[model samples]
Target: MAASSIANPRSDTANQVWTDLSPLLQFNNMEIINVADGVTSFLIHPEITTTVGRLKHCTFMAVLWEIWCSRNRARFQGQDMSAKHIINRSMLSIRAITIAANFQKILQPWLVALCQSNSRNEILKVLIPKVVRWLTPPPGRLKMNVDGAFNMTSGEAGGGGILRDHKGNMCCAFAKPYHGLNSSLSTEALALRDDLSICCSKGVYEVLLETDSLNLLHIATR
Candidate 1:
């Protein structure tokens, strides 16, 4: 115990040793390269720290703490667990959770879907709104409605919007072109700005712009 303590004492060296070992928990694509000897965090900014740390901690914790749940799932149940059935393992897990979380369980279907998706980016085109609606949802407002679209194959982007008055009557329905590949954020911004711009043109002020994208709300406010 004394020799082990001397060799692996709880110092910066020990911390870094932990860091190196924990990264094995990560998917190979998610690992950070080019970390210098003194660099403690990527981006070196406090804002990015929480983002990076949360991701690393969650993935690390998931793999380290829960591998038993995912590893050779059927063997513990006394079944034939082998190579041919291995890849389908996570899918079986996700399909079960997809029904339970009603698809709100973020990791399961998402990672499985990404691996199975046609373009991955294209799947996000269909997925982002569903996820947004589930997460930072806003009730439909009678005063404003927002819609957005992005097509990965053709790279075509478009948006439509509508605004109604207090009586729940339609005042206008609007549409416009979008140009960019900033993914969901790009289309989200255009949709909100389109409604705001229309309100500005008509000298109308103070509107409830209904949108599902919380990131866009933060971006638009800034």
Candidate 2:
């Protein structure tokens, strides 16, 4: 087995892509001893605490992971790998990680530009994050806040809710796992049903229901 398919891809298409992406990779196309050295050189100069450094680290790691997956597919499954595919797959991971890291404000423009042009040097405008605050319910009424999540890939669904008093103190909370749920809307409906059942059992009639889903809220109010 070779040291790394990413460092020295066998295919001409991959080689050309590596050349094109070398500018973004920074330390690429250099005479490095091994994969570790190449990665170390890529990360050594910049402090990972900085925005550009974080983006570089994520891109480098995602590229490496995609490259390894490509190598496995080519070697074990007798599949042909395309550098474009690797770039696309790696970008998905990079984008997700970037969002999770809260680097969207700083790094999103670069990612968008990278798709159009492989340039990573420009810093675009800053995006302010939206602020959300919870409001208290009327006096002597309990507020029920609920949320549900459905996984498109795994076919898993789950929901949870918390009941709070007018003072914003948690009274009760419940969570349940669901399988074979078709859509998130259905899950939200079921959560509402479960929460209402809990309230009914407790003889609580004056309840205010709160949910982040506008569709669910409209249907519920109607």
Q: How many clashes (backbone N, Cα, C below 3 Å) per candidate?
A: 0, 0
Clashing residue pairs in candidate 2 are none
Candidate 2 Cα errors over 4 Å, as ranges: 1-127
The C-alpha RMSD of each candidate to the native structure, in angstroms, is: 19.8, 8.5
Taken over the whole model, the C-alpha lDDT of each candidate is 0.48, 0.73
- For model 2, residues 1-222, the per-residue Cα lDDT tens digits are 433546565567556556656666665544565765665566687778877778777777677777778878888768888888888777667655655565634554556634422333543453423345799988888999998988786688999899999899998989998877899998888888898988888888778898988999899789
In model 1, which runs have C-alpha deviations exceeding 4 angstroms? 1-142
Candidate 1 lDDT, tens digit per residue, 1-222? 222222223344323433443332233212435333112342132332343333333333333222333233444545443322332343344334333444332443344432434332344332221222222223443467787778676677888887777666677878988886547678867887788888878766867777767887787679
Error of 2 at 220 (Å): 1.6
